[model samples]
Target: MPGLYHICYLSVAKLSALQPTPELGFEAIKEKTRKANSAAGLTGCIIFTGQHFLQVIEGIQEDVEDTFGRISRDTRHTDVRVLSEGPIEVRDFPEMAVNCGGDETLTAEALAEISAVLDYPQHQLHIREIRTLLSVLTQPSRKQDALLAG
Candidate 1:
């Protein structure tokens, strides 16, 4: 069977959510990914900024496609935009990967904040607030390609 290469753009921001610093928060999230990937036998790379995240997950063609689609509404993500997708003959993340440390900062509080917004009264959801939230939860994932090259 041929492996597959995939990239996903996910936006998650935690302006003041994570305690301490981004490096610590990144560590926390990476740990979670590690466990999840192990359980599912999936491989991928994840990157984060204070305002967004880009990830590339690969595995069985069917499984990878299904998994990538599920991230659209993942609890960890708020506003998701699928910038691009394509098929490949090999796994991009042969064994799951992550790069978050050494001066790396984290941002994903916006995703949590948006989830909270859903609890508010419907009338309170302003257009501007939604737009801001989208921006906060939107991240470009082009670097995922570079991650492999790097």
Candidate 2:
């Protein structure tokens, strides 16, 4: 049962100015990430706060690790620090290979929630808490279902 579950990780990185505009660069990055993640059977959400990127990825152990490996090497990400990683019984993001686009309010809420979870020392985090945090951050509201709950 444990092996059948998905591996999830939270990471934060500085955004790089690789395109003419941050929005343009983010779109390109997200497009590439979505396609690659779908091919790898991965699922997750990424929240960009203009200055930084916070993301969570979930998939089979090897697939998740491999995806992270590629992401870590990408020039667009810097100071990538994984906040937490482990196996989970359920996927926090079951529908999307990658979820990135949203208004600034959504981004702010997600970042604040993530910050609250990370406020605990890494070693102090429990698997259940991690799962809960991911669920809370990634779950789309009823109104957003039409747009993000694919």
Candidate 3:
């Protein structure tokens, strides 16, 4: 019933601020993403910023990681950067979705702390964006909560 998942943010190349392409725009592929993931039984979130794509895939660890590997080789995009990848004791996300405005800043220290927060329950945590989610968990203020969130 529970398994690991992979969370990564792919920073795509630059695009027009005034007029961006649908492939890179966060608002352009909502329905398509949801339908595709739903059909494939793959749950994840895709954050598009008209430049980069932050996708979090949650499923059986093997399936999710394999999918990430597949995406890395996909010829549809140019740049593919891996933000995070590992086996979570629990599912950080149990479904596929996407959102915009994930502009929170983070540090290497915070990223390390976040590594412990991924095993949290959906409602016990207040994090929505991937960056902030990792930052908050890594914070000392959140260290204690990580156990509770888990």
**Candidate 3, overall lDDT?**
0.51
**Span of 10 residues, lowest total lDDT, candidate 2:** 141-150
How well does each candidate superpose onto the true structure, as a TM-score? 0.52, 0.68, 0.51
Error of 3 at 125 (Å): 19
Off by over 4 Å in 3: 13-20, 23-29, 95-150
Per-residue lDDT for 84 in model 2? 69
Q: Give lDDT tens digits, candidate 2, residues 24-79.
A: 77777888989999998888877665655667888888888888888788777776
RMSD, one per candidate, in order: 10.4, 5.5, 10.1
Which digits, one per residue and each the tens of the lDDT, describe model 1 over residues 53-137? 5566656667667777776655556667554456756654453344332233223443334344444446344533433233322
> How much is the lDDT of residue 110 in candidate 3?
37
What lDDT does each candidate get? 0.52, 0.65, 0.51
**Residue clash pairs of candidate 1:** 11-137, 12-108, 13-108, 13-109, 13-110, 14-108, 14-109, 50-107
Best by TM-score: 2
